[model samples]
Target: MGSSRQCFQRFLEQKNIVTNLLGKLEENTGVYYLPTGSIAFLAFCLIFGYGASLLCNLIGFIYPAYASIKAIESPNKDDDTIWLTYWVVYSIFGLAEFFSDIFLFWFPFYYAGKCAFLLWCMLPVACNGSQILYHCPIHPIFLRQQASMDSLVTDLSGQALDTAASLTREATKAGMTHLQKNK
Candidate 1:
């Protein structure tokens, strides 16, 4: 048994497969330096195995709730705006997830997939969820609407100014004629 276990370990190390897999998992979950055969790893496995729903609830409900309350109390305009935008985008994501679940729930690794997606969305690193949604869709739409509104305002203001100038010229001519008649 000992010899076979040693051989398996050697094979895993030689291929570097286990190490790479663990590294990727740690990168996504933010749980690093957890040895595979250690008690902590076993505990993590057990908790996640049975308490995945609970974990999802905490992440989905607790964090957002806390962040929203904190955002309201925050004095920094930029920070508040960032938090509010996150919530708006996240809400849209939630709606998409709801529709996706009808098909995705049939998969064996649905929960794991969902957790990975949520992590990607929330992670502050490059190509993260919030950044993708904001830059790809939300920001562009806002920019287009703002540009259209600005053009409309400019056109309306120009027309108003021209009308005012025409009225002023007519009023001045009438005043001069009245003065001449009085003389």
Candidate 2:
């Protein structure tokens, strides 16, 4: 039991490390994106939950579970308990989707569509949180990428210009030498 607990702790640490990397990457990129786990949770909920919710007549409950997992597993708080929670939430997504499908008219399309849309809307609000609390951390990374790309283009243009100038100089020198010889 203790070993199991230790193993769980390791899992939590791994999840947090990933979350931290994701947060850094998000900050580096301009577009605010969800962490991989949240994205996974959302996908599982939508893909799995849609069907489960319908089959089990539990769409309403499952939808909330999916949303809650994403909300609760923020970048700052990463641990084994939360990681386990994510898996539990994902399991719920599967069951919920399965149940939802059985009951709902649509098997996958409309039901999944609703959940996806709901998640899509949440991202902007997530990004808008104050920097001190929940700012879109990936914005800086994006800016840096843009700056780097721009600089790379500028360098390419400079090189092209140099090549053209060098060609022109060589052609002019050759022409002048030929004329002098002819004269």
Candidate 3:
């Protein structure tokens, strides 16, 4: 963990081709700013200003989607588990957000908090938000409700099939009546 943190710090500190290009552009533009200023500005917008929702959603969605795709391709079972856990956590978050979004949008720093939460849930660490929430809260509730949920799903499936069959029969009768009239 310590080594990984050190590696991350080193990565942040290193300046390469992209940094050099941005530096030259800043110099020519007669502006003095750190290479990371753009990121800071973006973060500021996400936290306090307009377009925060869009930015927060992009942060929540794009990276995990890309990571999930890569996880599908990878041979490692652990990465697959990680991505699956992320999706489960994300799904629950989405479900809760769906019901609360109208009111939540009016709250101060909501997008910022959501964005931070999304980032936490997607973090690569072992004890990331997704894993913690799943293990501590979600898994137990799922266990308790699994049987009831299965029964409800079964009932719904049967009803759906019955409805589809009735619809098909009605459509067939209509088609037959039209064909008979033409004949």
lDDT of each: 0.66, 0.53, 0.85
Lowest lDDT sum, 10 consecutive residues, model 1, at: 37-46
Model 3, 1-183: lDDT tens per residue?
999668555644557444566678788886666545766887899878789988988878887887788889988889989888988999999999999999999988898789889988987689999999999999999999999999999999999999999999999999999999999
All candidates in order of TM-score, best leading: 3, 1, 2
Give the residue spans of candidate 2 off by over 4 A: 1-144
Q: Write model 1 residue lDDT over 1-183, tens digit each, in one string.
A: 999578546644553434566667778878655434443443454345667655654555555566567668878676566556667677787788788868865676555656556655655345667778888998888788998889999999999999999999999999999999999
lDDT score at residue 3, model 1, on the 0-100 scale: 100
Clash pairs detected, candidate 1: none
Model 3 CA lDDT for position 33: 62
Local accuracy of candidate 2 as per-residue lDDT tens digits, 3-71: 956854454356443446666777787535445455566557656663533533343334445545765
State each candidate's clash count: 0, 33, 0
lDDT of 2 at 9: 48
CA RMSD per model (angstroms): 16.5, 20.2, 4.6
How displaced is residue 96 in candidate 1, in Å?
A: 1.2
